[model samples]
Target chain A: MSRTRVHNFTISLDGFATGEGLSAEQPFGHAGHRLHQWMMATAFGAPIMGLPGGSSGVDNAFAQQHEPGIGAEIMGSRKFGPPGWQDDPNWRGWWGPNPPFHTPTYVLTSRPRSPLEMEGGTTFHFLDAPGAEALKIAQEAASGKDVRIGGGPTMLRDFLAAGLIDHLHVVQVPVLLGRGVRLWDGLEGLEQQYQVETVSTPSGVTHFTFSR
Target chain B: MSRTRVHNFTISLDGFATGEGLSAEQPFGHAGHRLHQWMMATAFGAPIMGLPGGSSGVDNAFAQQHEPGIGAEIMGSRKFGPPGWQDDPNWRGWWGPNPPFHTPTYVLTSRPRSPLEMEGGTTFHFLDAPGAEALKIAQEAASGKDVRIGGGPTMLRDFLAAGLIDHLHVVQVPVLLGRGVRLWDGLEGLEQQYQVETVSTPSGVTHFTFSR
Candidate 1:
């Protein structure tokens, strides 16, 4: 069965998924970009970005898990693009040529846009459907593989509220931004139960996998 | 003389400061309320909340640090209320009667609101100033004591952009909200440095104080 899993999401001490105000110059906002420092240095990141030579130790092991059998991905509008840029429908993503995900990606957006075709196997499909509808589409597209929930706190909140996500992995960095768009803002009544699957990594990146 | 200090702040491994959708019933969101579980058992938390008996060992020591002398507190509008709530001029804060902070607090917002008076010396003053200005007000109100930058991320990002914060103590708990808010988003260009002051806690609360 294809399951919706949220993996390798990094967050700051304050409680923001990504920094507020999306822009090409400042994609993740002020301190928001610091969340990916660990992933950028690992072997997993090297191959993904087409870089040469990277460490394959514990860091690499954790990084490898980020991209497994991910057949499809879902992200919020903020993670997709700026407001006006979406109108063109040609602008794919912040990541230029040879994007990360080499698979189908479903973007949750209010505005209507055509499916974006990238260099790799990645296809950005803008979904006007509601949260559950988008998830269903992504799940079907995922085949038997797992569907990754690419984030922007609001999107994740929607999935979490609907009890659609099965697994979650968050990498807590050592920095503190103090403020931004909080991911935990409207998640009060969710009655879900999760347990710590594993806890390793001494470099402050603690990997936690929770299941409903 | 600017001294580096780490005010012990506990966070879940999933990167939630408190819980989602902070309401009077559920101040902390879903599993997020448990983020402060370690602190509540500490001696510092017990005494502050007027609890008679509590753990007095290392947990207490760490918890005591959380109550570091704060001359003033800085928060964003979101931490105070919703978007237009500031227009009222009479709406104080979520904290009724006795607020958490006994000292003065400076709220960062675009629209101006009247000073909110609370019992036990807590007063909310709106500051239209930017990150630097708010820090200046906090520093003055601190009266040589440290000024705490409390929030929801945007406010913290501003202070971090200005390189004002001296120390940061982050406690990593075990839990993942999958998404809510993140702390380190827009902190890329600023050049800052830090050294770990201390790391000792049995309750999984690792204290790290950074200095430039």
Candidate 2:
């Protein structure tokens, strides 16, 4: 079964996945990297920071679940780049030559561009489609493997609201981001659809996994 | 020293403390009793429902912490009664004759009325005061004991935003209310002052305690 999963999508206590004033220089805006500090301290996330070692605690255990059966990723346009990435002709991505998503990564945007293949099997395929439509394209590209909903909040909220997510993992950080793009907006009765499990690590971040 | 604290205050995943269309019949509005269901199942909360026994687990431990060190309570007008409660002269609060407060409970409202003394120690004092002024009055009434900030979300947000709270215990309910009175508005960078601790119980609700 081709499942659609969202792993390690971090949000503030107020449910803001990213923060206000997000720009090219400040990816997460006022939030900075506060939302992802827990992940950075984890063993799975440490390698991304070029660190030799990190905590192998519960955080690392959850962080390592990001790339298991994930063959294709569908991310929001904001997640692909900053505000005006479409205007810039040379905007490949934030991840330099070789991006982290080692799959056929689909970027949902109104203004579509040609597929830019990166190193390590990662390719940026810009698609001018809705969430469901984008998911279908990603699913086909995923082949036998599952599709990953790479988020920036708005995209994930739309997918969850539309009942397209199969497995969703959310990390709740303690900080309160006053204003930002919220993840739980319009998701009123979302719990009724999934079996939710939660665990709080020593680092003070609570991990919530909603599985259908 | 009288410390101001908020305890067992539950909010939905999207930061809604209470749902939309709140009325006298539905005290917590569309939220119903979903937010406090975890507390209701605890030994401390079970007694309120006339239950002989309940779970004495981590939820119970946190629920029991509500009363011990409190002498006075200050709640928002919305928490005391329904929206048009001030108009009705016969309104003596929803918590009947012998209310659970058992202390001088201050209700912040623009339309002040005479104090209604109940059967028990609980007395409803209507005051037209802001968060700080109300806290001062509550502190005096509390004497040496700690003063509890009884919330309905909007009131708590005000106290929190004003930086008048010394301790705050927020229960993150799994359900998302979607539309309602939010608790985390204007509370950015709140983690800086408080030492936060998170524990997710088997009841599927996460307890977050922020203490200075």
Candidate 3:
């Protein structure tokens, strides 16, 4: 069965997945790279940033799960770029010409654009649909493999609230963003539904995996 | 040299220390005892609630730190009692005659009342002083022992914001309280000052200790 999974979703201690005032220049706003520093230090994340080597410990073990079985990805439009990305005609994505996603990635947006094929097997498909609708499209595109719920907090919270996620992995970094888009907002009684497992790494980031 | 410390301060994944609709009847409000359930299962916490033979694991290791070095306690008015506790002359505290805090516990409230001495060494002293002044009084009462900053989120945040705390131990409970009093508000860049250490126990709670 093709499951909907969310991996490597990082959030601050105060539950802010991404910081406020996100722009084209500052993608994560004032948060900078603080939230993702742990992942960056991992072997899986280093090469993505063009680094030579990284740690192969607990953080690397979880960070490497981002690719393996993921066939299609459904990301919020905000994850593709900053706010007002739809207004910009030339806004491809933050990942440049050859994006990290080698799957048929679907971007959820009000303004759906034509299919844009990048290098490797990655293809950007825009859709103006809700959580369930977007998941269905992504699942269909995923074929026999699983669909990855790529997020920027708003869409992740929506999918989580709707109980569409089968496997959810969130990295909780020890930092307070103070004000930002909270990932755990309206996610009351979430632990009741899933079998939650938490493990803290030496790098000072706790990984939470909620499996149904 | 008496250091100010905060221990066993539990909060939800969303950063809520206590749930909304807190009253005299429901001290922790809609949150019930969910936030402190992990602590309750600990050896130190179980005996406090009249329970016997609890787990002496990682949770207990952290839970037991509440009283060892502390001499005096400083808690917010909300922590001492509910919202309308000041109006009620008969209101002592939620901890009953033999309160757990066996020290001179200072309650920061606008309407300061006469000292209420309980059966235990816990004497509730109402004060209108700010975080710094309250710390000063608590430190004097603590003598050479360390002073503990007891919380109800607001006061803890104030003490944390004022940089009056030397050690802070926060247990991140897995559950998410949709709406409540947040503890991490206005605490941005907190990690820069303190040497943070994260450890996730098998009880599904992440223990975060920040020491300067």
Give the alpha-carbon lDDT of every model. Answer: 0.69, 0.91, 0.91
Candidate 2: stretches off by over 4 Å: none
Model 3, B9-123: lDDT tens digits are 9998888899989987789899999999998898999988889889988899888899898999999999988888889999998887899999999999999999998987999
Candidate 3's docking class is high
Per-residue lDDT, model 3, residue B160, is: 88
Model 3 C-alpha lDDT per residue in residues A1-212, reported as the tens digit of each score: 99999999999988888898899888999889999989889899998888879999889999999999888999998999888988888888998788999999999999999999999889999999999998888888889799999998999999999999999999999988888888998889988899999999889889999999
The lDDT of model 3 is 0.91
Q: What is the lDDT of residue A42 in candidate 2?
A: 85
Best by DockQ: 2
What are the per-model C-alpha RMSD values against the true structure?
8.4, 1.2, 1.2
Candidate 2 local lDDT, A107-164, one digit each (tens): 9999999999899999999999999998888989999899999898998989998999
The runs of at least 3 residues in candidate 3 whose Cα sits more than 4 Å from the true structure, single-residue gaps closed, are none
Model 2 CAPRI rating = high
For model 1, residues A85-171, the per-residue Cα lDDT tens digits are 766646878788767888889888778577878888888888888888998888888888889998888889888877788888766
TM values, all candidates: 0.60, 0.97, 0.97
A-chain TM-score, model 1? 0.89
Candidate 3: the clashing residue pairs are: none
